[model samples]
Target: MNELNPLDRIRELCEQRKWSYYQLSKASGIPYSTLNTMLNKENMPSLPTLQKLCQGFGISIVEFFEPDRNLQGLTKDQALCLSLFTSLSQEEQQLALAYLKGLSRTL
Candidate 1:
């Protein structure tokens, strides 16, 4: 696997979401100053910090580091749903799944 720069990956994810660093800081529960200093100095984040970032990005650490995989099988709507679901907090995700289960049961 090619070595990827974590900072560049973070920037790419932010660009994909059209998010500012402040937005990321809020989502990741990271302080803006720490994030800014890390990026400005090109310092690598420790594992826990990286985990917070991955959580904020709605992805796993494996997904964050892995090369992009083909997602062509998903329809646009399905992909959108997945993206929205991933962005939710853990509790919200569980609630969403329960709601979907309830809806499915009515069918």
Candidate 2:
């Protein structure tokens, strides 16, 4: 497999969310100037910073690097559902799962 550029990955994630750099800065809790410098200067974020970015994107670090792997064989709607599901809070996720289960029983 070819190597992935971290900066490009960040850009891709931001684009996926329809977020501008300023929005990302707010979500990631990184100063806009710092984020701007890092992206513009091609500087890689440190581990903690990367973690914050993943958190901001509502994903884990593993998902950040291999986003498509798990979703590869899923239908678009399934993938979208999974993406939306991951963004929910823990309690919300449980409720969603319960709702899905109820729906499944009716089928």
lDDT per residue for candidate 1 within 3-72, as digits (tens), equals 9899999988887677788888988999999999998899999999999998887788987887344345
Deviating ranges (above 4 Å) for candidate 1: 70-107
Give candidate 2's error at residue 67 in angstroms. 0.9
- Model 1, CA-based lDDT: 0.83
In candidate 1, where is summed lDDT lowest over 10 consecutive residues?
A: 63-72
**What overall lDDT, based on C-alpha atoms, would model 2 receive against the true structure?**
0.85
Q: Candidates' lDDT values, in order?
A: 0.83, 0.85
Please state every model's RMSD to the true fold in angstroms.
Answer: 3.5, 4.0
TM match of model 1 to true structure: 0.68
lDDT of 1 at 4: 88
lDDT of 2 by residue, 18-69 (tens): 6788978887799999999999999999999999888777788889888877
